[model samples]
Target chain A: MRPAAAPKAIVALSAAVAAPVHAHLVETGFGAFYDGIAHVAVTPADLIVVVALALLAGQRGTRAARYAVFALPVAWLAGGMIGARWPSAAALPLLTTLSFALAGALVALNAKVRDVGVAALAITAGVLHGLVNGATMAPAGAGALALGGAVSAIFFLTAILSAEVTALPVGWPRIVVRVAGSWIAATGLLMLGWLARSAP
Target chain B: MKTQMKRWKQYAALGAAMLVLAPATALAHREAGQAAGFLSGLAHPVSGLDHVVAMIAVGLWGAVLGPPAIWVLPVAFPVVMALGGLMGLLGFPLPGVEIGIAVSAIVLGAMVLAQLRPPLWVAAALVAFFAIFHGHAHGRELPEGTSALLYSLGFVIATGLLHLVGILLGEAHRWSAGRQTVRAAGGGVALAGLFFLWRAVA
Candidate 1:
């Protein structure tokens, strides 16, 4: 058992290092690079929430729950693509609405689950979303990419934390997801309002 | 015991009938350029307190009506709504549609809570009427082509799911509390509609 486990640890370490390189694939310009750094500096609270979701995602295996687990990353990927394409203030609400609605749909679809695989996928997807966003924030060129890599790692850890907390289902988990969803909707609304003003 | 069970059955049937019979009412208008997916998935219920309440109320009523109502009422809503949406997209008018949508919530909520028992066709007719407004709002605001279809699909799916959720909640509180909670929610929705009306007209 010890001999077998040793290689597992080594492999895990190797894969972990490789993950960051693959994660921070987005390129940034000089203008937005500083803004990314500023956002990182100012928003410690966002980081905390990301961490919490990750921990919660670590637990649970219900189909809707699992889809919700993946929602953020899916939103992130989609958002990044949209953001890349538009790169204008006017596009933010559209992106936000698109992201959140997608998340809600994924969460609503109650599917049957097999086992741990669901949990694992949910955790991966959740972290991927945070990392992708964080990467986008990094400074232009090499600096931006490097900072994004670091943020992605932090995001991954946070996802683990979210999954961990979510594991402990005290009686009802669906209700929790609904409650969480309500909050997500509220946040989306606020973002929508801000985007509307900013664009006009 | 059989008589008591039958009485309970009758009450259940009445509850179900009211949802189907709710007078035509509508709520929450969709905007032009809105995505079909977003309109159907998110906006339908979220746009107004009344829509949220009535949609769920319809579902709960169906559950009380029995298994057939469970599927039938929800199915009826989307199908009717789609037709209405098409009319709107085609530039056909649903007069006083906004008001109708709001009233749908107010009247349906009261009916369900008050346990009003109308004849079956009357109930179906009312729901069908309101569904037009709901569907028109959906179709009127849609973009051209695939997006519109997707948006309509989203709303229909969301509406169906809302009904399912209402049923589950109603089942959960099989006792009086769940039913009452729904009733209270209905009242609140009506009150909010009054506020919305004031805002719209004033």
Candidate 2:
């Protein structure tokens, strides 16, 4: 079916976005700490998402999903240009939130959600995850691409893995996704609290 | 099997081609206000950790947001941001500009974590204000005697690509097991914003 095409498209996109990102991340003056976190923690997760999405959607969804995934990096470029030229407070955050939330929503809508409650939870968790990552970029050179690429890779991989198990028993899929969402939500809460306390 | 391998080779070639063309166009710089020069303006975002993280993150988030949001939000950012940059170059003083930019990181992070649903105008206003600081940076840093068109083009293209990174990452949350990991990563970014806030004031 059409859903099967998602994963393939994501993989293709990953390949396209990764090259420049890699060069940019490697160029960071901050040394290897941020790079290591991005590459190890973030990138693998992104790649896994692609694999899961591909598995779930199979061959049919590839074209659409591929383009969908490919569009992320392109949007990154455009956003950078905006910030470079304008650099306003309100516009920056607004664009940042909308962009990340929309992408997460797209993936959720395309895939099957066994329960509406769980789906909402998953979506909310996804937004939290995306927001935090968006708030902390390297700012200069091609570093944005590099950092963004690392995070993108993580989500792509996750999509791939989710897609892989699409055919598993329905209950099983929901349970797995729910559990993951719970952990993510908890982490977000922790970060939120920490940030609030730390802020003056 | 032979056919599969052949297809793989073709894909590989395409990938290679994309890689070659990627660097020049694929990279993004910070919106450094209305700098008078080329390299300095371009170098603004790269100079500070705060601007770099939030700018790229905005692009990445746009990528995650899906098609219309991705396209509209990213498009709106640069267009508006450029306006903000113009204001800065003209010596329009925005009070608490630095603090506001830092606050944008905090607020944006909370919005993502909270999944707040605000009106479209709200989003526009938030981005518009933040763009001023970013634009100012560019204006202050841009090299003198550079073609404004070329400099703008260079930065705009780079900025869009940054949003693409966020979109892809946000989309990654769809995977089964990886959802938590992605969320955790987002949380990490928010935490980093806290660090930047401290740095800005210190």
Q: Which ten residues in a row have the lowest lDDT in candidate 1 chain B?
A: B25-34
lDDT at residue B52 of model 2 (Cα atoms): 60
Candidate 1: interface RMSD equals 26.7
Where does candidate 2 chain B have its weakest 10-residue lDDT segment? Answer: B29-38
Q: A87-161 in candidate 2: lDDT tens per residue?
A: 342123323323322333333333453233323333333333333233334333334544455445544654555
**Per-residue lDDT of B64-155 in model 1, one digit per residue for the tens?**
55544545566566556656755665557678777777777766666666655565556667777877776666434533432332354455
**Span of 10 residues, lowest total lDDT, candidate 2 chain A:** A182-191
Predicted structure 2, TM vs. truth = 0.39
Off by over 4 Å in 2: A1-200, B1-43, B63-67, B117-119
